[model samples]
Target chain A: MDEPIQNKKVDTPQDNSDVITMRHIAKSFGDNAILKDINMDLHKGENLVILGKSGTGKSVTIKLIVNLLEYDKGELKVFGDEVKDLSEQELKKLRTRVGFLFQSAALYDSMTVRENLEFPLKRILKIKDEKELEDRIKEVLDSVGLPDAIDKMPSELSGGMRKRIGLARTIILKPEIMLYDEPTTGLDPITSKEISELIMSMQEKFKISSIIITHDIACAKITANRMMVMDKGEFVAEGTFEELENSSDDFIKSFFKL
Target chain B: MANAPAASYKGILEEAGNQVLFMFRFFRNIFRFDFEWEEFIRQCYMIGYKSFPLVGITGFIIGFVITLQSEPTMKAFGAESFIPKMVAISLIREICPVVIALICAGKISSGIGAELGSMQVSEQIDAMEVSGANPVQYLVVTRILACIIMIPLLTLMADALGFAGSYLGVNLSNHVSPQLFFSKAFSSVEFGDLLPAFFKTIFFGFAIGFIGCYKGYNSNRGTESVGIAANSAVVNASLWIIVIDGIAVQLTNALGY
Candidate 1:
């Protein structure tokens, strides 16, 4: 498959300063080193796609960015605050500004779609009024193009619809940065394209910076402003899609071959 | 290739040992009250309030059946008048708390284990941490608190219902009135029997919730681990309840209760 067009800059409403930066981040589970001395920068209003084969620490990197997984050694900054030193109260405040779409959608099975969307808003943001909560829920649902499915259970939604709802829930708080992990993994090709389109629309509409982690070359091509290829828990190459395609690195060449 | 089976068995045993160690660590964390008070309240609601009907029903049935069954047995010794005493002692000191623990082990333990297991498998727990929610405080404390509060309340309700059932059961064969039955039941139940029994249930509730939450929260691997967590939570909690109850019985006996 050919690489998607590389658009360096598209005019958007949000600022384009550095949104997230990691310096020498290292994480290990017991003796198993999952990430090692990793460094990366994610700019605001940019969709940076991280491409790696399975178990290459792609998901772990996303976790670290959100401060979900602690790094044994290294500094991580989100919107200028050092994430490691922040207290629990401070972290909850920081988390509200960031949105994440989990790979499995991670929608609470016991909750309805509306409750799922309302959960963080009510629990974390403490949005109490019924009228405003309903309005915000409808607004996010409409943005994700699923306004009518608010009363439905998660089990009732199709794979693609669930992913969209997950995306909607992530954006309900209007986070400044969106981290999507394998957003298109289990979808049909057409559904995958729809998800990609939705990602683009979100970027355009919200102008939020995004970090999408996936093994899908097609997804990386369509969604990324900048792309990084990872191998064995380390970044092997990084650039615009065109720049990476033209590189002499055998792994990058072969990765893009299919 | 020839050594694969032997190696796999060894690996399984090692994994089992590690799981036991993990359980010990979880106990340590619970004693430290790892999560916040608000989180504890939420878990109490989940474990206790949500499980009221099942626990209530179990308590009622056990009380009724024990009364009916003991009627025939006591009649053989012309001790049919002692039915209330027997039912009261059994419910307050043994059956009520133990049954509630077992029921909770089934309901709350499995529910917590499955909930946490799914959270772990689905990575919501991870998401919480990433989003700056303290997963430990958010998940662990709420559940532990729920167990502590709910278990005692459930036992209290169960104790009442069981006595009612025993009264009804006694009426089935004999003419013992509700008033006479309660009086006889109370006369046999001193503070010694009631205090230790009720007190031990708090620990029972705590054990079930803590072990279940611990199992589920730490669960990894894949879908199968969730089942393992649920299973282990119930097994460990029930075992601990029995062991703890036995110790309480011994201590009470030594203290001349």
Candidate 2:
């Protein structure tokens, strides 16, 4: 029985250190415990994948990190500031630095692709200079390799294209950290790979730290520098892909058996 | 599972309590948080400006038809002078606001519900929160505020259109001049009849927006939940409007208004 990987100690510049850290986190819906005593650290420029079977609270973990779901007990800190205690204005300011790609791509259907991408930029950031806004839109869209999708409605795009557009929207703010919630959940194998590759490429290009929640082993193996498997509301294993492959735990072994 | 009757009754009571709590929280949030002014303006545009054409057209047609249809009956009584006053009081004091609300309950409530339900299904609301935006303030508050501002304006427009329609209706039957008709209408209207009807619409607007947003915001299950949210929003909002209107009428009558 291999022991779980010891939590790594992250070295920070005397000036800057943790981007996000969660301590003793727990959440429940009625009597059902969704997450239990979760502790994790996300450092700068690291891609962390949370691998879990369906209904294992993988998405809940992401939601907790982003303050989407309030935890019953815990301290969640983003940029070394306590998230739960922040004022509304402070929360809005913090959001400018984080980008999230929702599971369904979650594009506003009433708006065009360009408008969807521009929504946060204009509404939240108040970027009124038309040329600069257009340039930013083009840059993000080009980075995701969908430069031509500007005028297209979300319904007009393919699943892969929509995910790419979602990625484009997520990175529009040039966030320091990105959260991807099952980014490839419903796509074909080929499209899923495209999304996985895009996720990796985007992380590398932007030097952005990421937490990706997915059930796709192929995606986890290809993109995660470090991976954690969660089962029944707790993390059972955490290690590099090679280290996890050599793990002897029945749950971990059987997970990758196919 | 075998507890049967007692357990089932308890479950029903629990569901009822939860609904009451939901409504209570929905109302509380409006006053508890500092109102977001920009969002309020945006909502006003959504609820008021966008809805004007539909409410306006409907009001006009209803008024005109009512006058045209009622002329013969009033003529038989030789009380043709009372046509404008009757139409004015009926439409302004009751019919117009309820009718506009029903139409809006269909249009705006369903729209808000479907939009929010899709967001819930797609995790967009979660995305907003994670992005450091308050999904409630950003989405729900703006919409409800828009209703607060827009619904009354719509009702007022409906009242005017109903009067115009009555004017046309009267002309079709008898040659009552516009001045004569309006004078008769004004003579019959008091502050009592006008104020309560107008005031009650604010509650109507709040109900429509609140229900639509609540159903949509809390929707779960999956893709189909959006449709269910939209349907429920319309159904619940229309029901609440009628209920509230009835209460308002009773209260106004009690006060001798």
Candidate 3:
């Protein structure tokens, strides 16, 4: 929030050590052009929120960095390596360092909350020590304000609880990069604000860089160190929350008016 | 409407191609480390042991009904003593395996289709992938292998129970001893007949698991698609079972069984 907002024409400082960089990235499906020459950079330990209405490629842009969807053209790099060029094994290894929280929280319904937490630990982290596993699960559960939810089933949790658990699961790996797709999309305002603050606090605690894709204005204001507004596959505004709020651009103004 | 037929044909081709590719991917990841032994055994319990009671009942009824219905005809031909042989051959070569598969296709395939379909809709699969997990290994391989192992084992149980039912049916009118019934049952059931019947069910099991996985894994992101996946799983797996049965019969017939 303290980061100085750059003017629309003035470029933000770019360093070679940026965790993720995208230049002139373009992606399309069939005849529909979703992303057109998009450029982005996520500095280490920064929360960069991309705000836009639905179908503007806000989520797709972040997804591209994880190589969930390939950029049709232009350059996209994660940890300075070209995403599309990575081998399958490399891509999988890269994904381990990048945590993605889906909109639904996507908890495995068949498993209890403890099993959900243990899944990535056992599967991805290959953590075998029972004591260490329990300690790590408890650490994340407490961080997300759900210490007692360890033994509960996912179906028993409410929407806000599920989101907290999802965040806990994502941050358990202490991923260098966290990708939140509509983290607060389907929750009450109080819950939404809670999630936004959780994201901010987690960023500070873990020193993780994040790309949060959402149209929730409160979410952007609370979580974003720098914010960008995307429309029709390209960024239209880029700055701090207050900077974008005070801008004269009609589109940017309309978003902040609410 | 001009391209409707072509589009339909294209969709089918694409699906077939994807399913084959899916099967290969399943095969590739199966042998890798993290074999999901716990999940595999759990699936064996669900898909195999849970299927036994139903298969047993169906097998018993098939044995009984066949013995009862064919008894009058065999009596007319003065081949009444061959009733056990008739029931055994039908149960082994045709009835038990095919019926068990159909029953399993209805139960297991639909259940898998719905479970995975709902998971897909909820984005759990993507969550697994994004978290650096092998979804195919954890989900598909365990379920498919469970089916491959379970279906055949269940079919064997069915074969044995069917003979019991046949014996009970035989005693309904005539008092036949257990020794007499079993001897006559195995009279026509040769080593050749048993081999094909035993081996053919592996294919049936594989088809049930594969088709169910294909349908459920690829189902679109909608609640309605869950139903579609389950329905289509049953339909496709049943067809695959019949087609495989036909092929096994042809192979056996060619071998002069």
Compute each candidate's TM-score over C-alphas. 0.83, 0.83, 0.95
* TM-score-superior candidate, 1 or 3: 3
Tens-digit per-residue lDDT, B1-257, candidate 2? 67899899999898568667766765666775445676678678877889889999999998998887888898899988888889999998899989999999999999999989988887778666665545676788778878877898899999998899888888875787888989999899998888999899999999899899888998985889999999999999999999999999899999999
User: Judged by lDDT relative to the true structure, which candidate is superior, 1 or 2?
Assistant: 2
Query: What is the Å distance of residue B154 in model 3 from its true position?
Result: 0.8
Arranged by lDDT, best first: 3, 2, 1
Model 3 residue B238 lDDT?
A: 100
Pull out the clashing pairs in model 2: B43-B146, B64-B165
The TM-scores that each candidate's chain B achieves against the reference are: 0.85, 0.91, 0.97
Best by TM-score: 3
Location of the lowest summed lDDT over 10 successive residues in candidate 2 chain B:
B26-35
Say which candidate scores most in lDDT: 3
Model 1 interface CAPRI class: acceptable
**RMSD each, Å:** 7.1, 5.6, 4.1
- What would the per-residue lDDT of candidate 1 be over residues A207-247, giving only the tens digit for each residue? 99999998777887899999988888788888998898898
- Which DockQ values do the candidates obtain, in the order shown? 0.43, 0.55, 0.81
Candidate 3 interface RMSD after superposing interface residues: 0.8
Instruction: List the pairs of residues colliding in candidate 1.
Output: A68-B130, B35-B137, B39-B142, B40-B141, B40-B142, B43-B142, B44-B146
After superposition, candidate 2 runs with Cα above 4 Å error: A1-18, B1-54, B68-76, B171-180, B190-192, B250-257
The stretch of ten residues in a row with the least summed lDDT in candidate 2 chain A is A1-10
Give the residue spans of candidate 1 off by over 4 A. Answer: A1-16, B1-77, B132-142, B164-179, B250-257
